[model samples]
Target: MLYPIFEYFDQVLDIPGTGVFRYISFRAGMAALVSLIITITFGKNIINWIRNKQIGETVRDLGLEGQNEKKGTPTMGGLMIMAGIIIPTLLFANINNIYIILLLITTVWLGGIGFLDDYIKVFRKNKEGLAGRFKIIGQIVIGIVVGATLYFHEGVVVREFTNPVSIEQGMVETPAFKDVKTMKTTIPFMKDNELNYEKIFGFLGDSATPIFYILIVIFIVTAVSNGANITDGIDGLAAGTSAIIGLTIAIFAYISGNAIFSQYLNVFFIPNSGELVIFCAAFVGACVGFLWYNSYPAQVFMGDTGSLMLGGVIAVLSFALRKELLIPVLCGIFVIENASVIIQVSYFKYTKKKYGEGRRVFLMSPLHHHYQKKNIHEAKIVTRFWILGILLAIITLATLKLR
Candidate 1:
């Protein structure tokens, strides 16, 4: 909304300060600051409302440390994050940009699903929350939407360079550019960082490429979303890690969107990728502000309400920039946490089937709980996880030159 006004002022009236909005860095910084103020200032009031409504979390006998103490903590605090992200994006971003529009839709769509789950848990008092199948269905619905959009939308196109440049001196060796349709994504530490999805079905030749690409997109979206949802097991852990990841990706998005940076970095130049920085700015601010209450002895829980959206939004952001393959490294914590559950469950089921009895894998499933089970202190666990997330972010960025 503000973009047009600033653009008009810059393009027509020749306004002095309004032209500042032309720089994505300036706008992103403003977006973060505005979102922070909105979330922090309105935080207490929203908490009070949640308290007044008795919309508190019902902690069961999970046997984890501090489990009983968490009972009755006000939840549904995802509203804070939503407010932080939405307001800034609306104010600082190019509202007409397809990427921004998609992000807004992603925020609202997944937020709706999460809000419904939280609602079922809070208002409906259904301890199980939204049915697992229904949540999965909602996530799949998002995957389809995102995948179809990326495939069909001309605005989501990518520019490919033949004989791509080396990562040395942090720069493309040969630049023969073409607007080619391919299913490539960035992968770290490879001879060629590009991992083409179409290559997966090499046996099928040309016809299998589209199917392969479509399936890969769906798989990535679903997996990334579920990874984020599972990682929400710890307070401040998911939110903080998300902010770190969002910030890192924002850098990538800016570089990718800028033709100069893209050429210097020897990477694909995405025309509209820079617009993602504004969306991610809102994302980072929302996570940090939410942490004000979500930290340690959390005042309010985000529940699935915020977790699902965080994951979905992150997934969509990466897909938009054609950087989805970087997710395993960028979101390593979420990946490990998710993998722990899948491994634990699979092993337990397999052992039970073979031995007629179940077995445990780490003391708990989500990996963070394994530390929690050792009485390692939740705050410490969350902090250490964040440190690892930072390291992963560094590695993800370092790939620009690490090759």
Candidate 2:
């Protein structure tokens, strides 16, 4: 919202400081600062309100150490995160940018779903919260919308480098490039990193290619979203992990949006995607600031509201940068958390059917809980996972040169 007014002041009125707003770096920094200020300043008040209103998390005894201490803690603190992110983005970002528009929509859509789930659990007194099927349906719907919009949006175009002046010098001086819309994504550790989705479904003809691509988009969105939700079991785990992931992607978004950097790095130049840097900045700031209260011996929990939106934002941001294929490596922690749960469930059912007794794997699921079951301190487990997340983020960023 503030972008246009500042732009007008800079361009028409020749305002000196207003010109700084045109820089993505400046705007991104401002967004992060604003997000941090909002989160830290108002977060305590929000927690107090939630507590006074009796909106607390209902903890179940799973026999893990320090498990029962979390009961009755003020929950649904994701509202603070949402406010921090949205308010700053609106003030600092280009609201008309297609990528920004999509991100805003994704935030509100998934946040609403999460808020409803938390409301059901806290207000309606339903431990089950929103039905599992309903959450999946909501995620699927948003995935379809994102995929379809990216596919058809006129603003979404990539500048492909047809000739390189010098691969060693990292230059793409040749003008043999064209900005076009294509269904391609960056694949990690490949000499020619671009993977076109059309080639995967060539046998299905042009008409079916888009459909297949959309289906793939839906699957990725749902998987990453749920992975983040599952990873939120411990304090500071999800928020801290997500902040790392967000910072890495913010770098990718900045480079992808910059023509010079994109050409010099031999990466696809996604026109106008640089605006996402503002959104990503706000995201990282929100997560990190929320950690003030969300850490060990938590003052508040983000509940489904924060987890779902965090995952969805990561998914959409990656998709916008055409780096969706790198999600497995970048989100390794979330992937393992999600896989552990799935494996535990499948194995228990199989064992019950085959041997008439349910067998267990890892004492508990989600991997982090397994450590907790082994008498590991919750704070120690969370810190270790965060270190792992940082390592994964470094590996993800290294892919740019690794190829």
Candidate 3:
């Protein structure tokens, strides 16, 4: 909102300082600083409120050391993270931009789902809080909305280019306007890196292209969001890992959005995507600040309030930037956590069919608890996971050049 005011002041009133807001980096930095301030300041007040209302996390005897001791620590501090991200974005970003609008919507929409689940568990005393079906429904609804808009929205498009082995080629420049195309996204470890979903139904010609392409995006959105949600089982694990992933994505978004950088790299140059940097900056700030209270011996649990939104935001941002394929690598932690659950359950069902009881796979699912059960300190586990997240982030960045 303040963007326009800064523009007016800079251009019309000739205010010297207002022009700095024009730079994406400047706005991104401002957003991060603002998010940090909001989290650190309001975090304490919310903690007190949660404690006053006895809105503490109910811990079953998880059998881990210091597990039950955290039974009454505050919960739902994700509200602080939400506020931190939203307010900064509104203040520092171009609110009219479609990407920003979609991000804000996803942030609030999935966040509301998580907050409701947390509320049900805390207030209604329902251990099952918002049935799994409902959560799936909410995620699917979001996926559909995001998928439809991304496919149908005219403002959303990518400017692709070609490379040459024999000679340097000029960018397709006819109308001085770049190619605004809606199709499949990029795939890693490939030569050309392009993978259009429309190709799935080439037999039907142009008619089936839109049908299959939209479904592909919807599937990707749902899968990534749920993957991140389930990965939130341990304190500071998801947040810490998400921060690292967000930083890498933020770098990719920066280069992808900048016309010159994208051309130099011979990659898709998405106009208006630079604005995403500010949103990601806010994301990193919110996650880091939440980590202050979310660290081992956590003062508060983010619950579904933080987890679902975090995952959704990551998914949407990756999709928006055509980096969804990088999720398995960038979000390796979430991917492993997700796969562990799938494997554990699938094996249990298989074993139960053959034997009398369901058997176990790692001490527990979600992967983190497996180590937690082996007397691994929560802090140590979280730290190592963060290291792995960093490792994955670096590997993901290398993909931009490796191919």
Candidate 4:
């Protein structure tokens, strides 16, 4: 909203400072700053409201130190995060841009699902929250919506380098490129990094390829969203880790949207994706600001509300920038958290079936509680996990040049 107003001031009235909004960097900075301000300024009130409404978390006896203390902390603080992100985005981004529109939709859609889950847990007194199948169904529905929009929307397209220019061949100029709709995505650490979904279905006709692509989309969305949801078991774990991931993806979005950067990096150029930088900026700011209250000895918990939206935003942002394939590295914390649960459950079930007694894997699941079982301080565990997330984020960025 503010973007168009500034544009009119700059273009029509020839205002001096309003022209700065034309720069994505400037707008992104504003978005980040605004989002941070919103989160920090309004966060306490939101938490107080949750507390006043008796919307506190129902903590289970996990046997970890300090676990019981968090029993009645106000929950569903994710509303603050959503407000921070959405307000800044609406002010700084081009609302008509398809990518921006999709991201906003992803935020609201998954946020609504998570809010519902949190609602069920707090208001209805259902510790189980929303049914697992229903949660999955919600994710799948959004996945289909996102996948179908990207596949069929005319605005969603990529520019491929058609003519190659090699320095060794004495060609001083860069290659020419053309815009075309494609199902291709960037693969890490590969010579020709682009992989098209159509080629994966070479045996089938072109009509069948989109079906496979949509299925892949659904799988990724569901997996990453759930991974984030599970990772929220500890304070500051999900928000801090997701902030790092969001920053890394924002870099990818900037490069993919810039034609010069895309050519130099030998990556696919996606037009209008620069707008995503603003969204990602808001995302990073929201997460970091939320960390103020969400950190160790937390005043509030984001519950499933924040976790689901965080993962969903990252998934959709990556898909828009063609960096979905890098999610394993970028979201390594969530991936390992998710894998730990899967492995622990599978092994326990197998052992119970074979020996008629359940065998444990880690002292607890989700990876973080394992450290807690080892008597590690919760704050220390969170810090180490955040450091690891930062390392993974760096490695994810390095893939652009490594290829």
- Sorted by TM-score (best first), the order is 2, 4, 3, 1
All candidates: CA RMSD (Å)? 3.4, 2.3, 3.2, 2.8
Across 161-256, the per-residue lDDT of candidate 2 in tens digits comes to: 576534446654555767898888899999899898888897888778778877888898899889999999999999999999999999999999
Please provide the root mean square deviation of candidate 4 (C-alpha atoms, Å): 2.8
Candidate 1 residue lDDT tens string, 240-312: 9999999999999999997667867777788777988999998999999989989988998887778888988
lDDT of 3: 0.85
Q: Estimate each model's TM-score.
A: 0.93, 0.96, 0.94, 0.96
Candidate 4, residues 39-148: lDDT per residue as tens digits? 89989988888999999999999899998889899999999899989999999999999999999999999999999999999999999999999999999999999999
Top model number, lDDT: 2
lDDT of 4: 0.91
**lDDT of residue 234 for candidate 3:** 74
- Candidate 2 whole-model C-alpha lDDT, 0 to 1: 0.92
Superposed Cα deviation of residue 336, candidate 4 (Å): 0.4
Worst 10 residues of 4 by lDDT: 164-173
Q: Where does candidate 4 clash, by residue pair?
A: none
Pick the winner on lDDT between candidates 1 and 4.
Answer: 4
lDDT of 3 by residue, 1-403 (tens): 9999999999999987888989999999999999988888788888899899999998877787778788887888889889888999999999999999999999999999999999999999998899989988888888878877887788888875444222227754432345666666888877799887667687788767766665766676667777778877678888898889888889998999986677667667887899999999999999998888888778888888888898889989998998888888998888898899999999999999999799989888778888988989888998999999999999998888888
Backbone clash total for model 2 is 0
